[model samples]
Target: MSKEYNVAILGATGAVGTRMIQQLEQSTIPVKSLKLLASSRSAGKQLQFKGQPITVEEATPDSFAGIDLVLSSAGGSVSKKLLPEAVKRGAVCVDNTSAFRMEPDVPLVVPEVNEAALKNHHGIVANPNCSTIQMVVALEPIRKAFGLKQVIVSTYQAASGAGQSALNELKQEAQDYLDGKDIQDDAEILPTKGDKKHYPLAFNLLPQIDVFEDNGYTHEEWKMIHETKKIMLGDMNAKYIKVTATCVRVPVPIAHGETVYFTVDDPSVTVDQLREALKGAPGVVLQDNPAHQVYPQPLNAVGKRDTFVGRLRADEENPGSFNMWVVADNLLKGAAWNTVENAECLVKDNLI
Candidate 1:
């Protein structure tokens, strides 16, 4: 008989954490037991899994006792503090946070893009940023078929990427607006929670995602630029790939969509070849049909695990450059599903 692992979920009540729970219930991993860990305030709450109610507990250093695997979606600081402790207690952690993503030792992974990288993990495997995860999935096959040289992406991100509270604010603000109530720019938590201003997302678009860095690129944009190279190429080879991104938060509530313009090393690569490459790509659903006016859209992508690709065409101005549209549920393949997929890879390889 195979071993049934004991598993734990950190940040159990957060938006992504809760979706992690849902994915776990349907996952093929033999979960002998499940532990839900969160801050003290969220402790004692009950979350349903596999038709049973599990109590949420306060996450302490000892929370990993006898746990074989951990799926963590906690904030970066919490992950930085607790993941090492979990590893020390003999648990393998798949962290869905930005804390260790750029670390030299950590593997920033999208399982479809770089499952083999998991072997290099000492104790922790980091999930790529939500936006980065979906884009890389769509691009990896193309990269394999035709060597990629440059990539430029602009994202139409959903409110849920900011967390459940941001989604709630969008709803409340939209309702207040529809009622002819004063639409206060009542900004508080978004673009970045710690940033100085908050703006209503109901009927507006924010040109920024995370707070801007000194270089003028927002942190979220930087993640797409950096994480793409990290996942596609190793740490050293990342510089060989030229990448730039503009990430924006739109009013959509579930899925994220992107327009990616990429240059392939093969000058002769045709639009048909690009479509064929993506058509057969794992984790990708090709939806390109121009004559009938078909394409991938956020409303069509919500709740789906596969990244949808459409509007594929060669750039007329730049030889070897092609543009395509990609969309996926930010909370699924973007976060929880990718985390679960990494855990599954670890189990199948017997690395944990």
Candidate 2:
């Protein structure tokens, strides 16, 4: 029999956390035990795993005792505080937060794009942002076939990217709007829960995702820009890849859609060539059929783990440039599934 490792899930009650549970249940890692860690308010809750009830515990510095693997999607602050504790207790952690992503020792990974990075982890691995995950999954195959030069992306992000409350708020706001009630007056989450200003996301689009930084880009946009380079090119080579993004919060409840325009280093790369590159790419489903009007959409992508890519075309204005549409479940491939995948890689590589 293969070695069975003890696994613990940090933030086991949140949106991504719950999905992490689902993904783990479907993973190949041999599990000797499963531990669910949440905050005190949610401590007594019992969540089902493989038809068994696992009691949620309040996470502390000592929650990681005897755990061999840790999958974390707790907020960044919680991760910043608790992940090191988990690491100190001898567990390999795959974190689904921004806290440690840019750290010198941490590997910010998308398994399809940079699975080998997991071998370099110093106890913790970082999962890229949801939007960045889908883009890179689609782009990596093309990059490998041709050569990537630059990327400019505009995202149609779903409400779930903001979290469960925001998803609930989107539903309420949509209903309020449909019933001719005031949405703006009760709006509090979309754009960002931490930001001062709030806006209705129903039947409308907010041009911002996270709070703005000094550079005039929202933090979410900044993540897509920097995280892409890190995942595609490593810290030393990341500066060579140019990436720019505009992230927006849309009314959709799950999955994220991106319109990406990229210039390949090889000027002769054709649209059909790009389509062929992605058709068999790992974790990528090629849905590009312009004649049949078949392409990736958020509704089709929801609840699925694969990143869907379509709308392949060459830029008429720029000979070496190409464009594509990418979509995936922001909560799954973007967060939970990626986190679980990293853990599987760690096990496969004997890094854990």
lDDT by residue (1-352, candidate 2, tens digit) is: 7899999999999999999999999999998999999999999999999999999999998999999999998899999999999999999999999999999899998989899889999999999889999999999998898989899999999999999999998999889999999788868887798888889898899998888999899999899988888888886247667899999889999999999999998998888888888888999999988899999999999899999998888899898898889999999999999999999999999999
- lDDT tens digits, residue span 1-352, model 1: 9989999999999999999999888788999999999999999999999999999999999999899999999899999999999999999999999989988889988988999999999899999999999999999999999999999999999999999988888888889889987766655677679798787887888998988999999999888888888899977247778999999899899999999999999989999999889886899999999999889988888878899999999998888999999999999999999999899999998999
Q: Provide the lDDT at 132 for model 2.
A: 91
Overall lDDT per candidate, in order of appearance = 0.91, 0.92
Q: Best lDDT goes to which candidate? A: 2
What's the TM-score of each model vs. the native? 0.98, 0.98
Name model 2 segments beyond 4 Å from true.
Answer: none
**How many residue pairs clash (N, CA or C atoms closer than 3 angstroms) in each of the candidate models, in the order given?**
2, 0
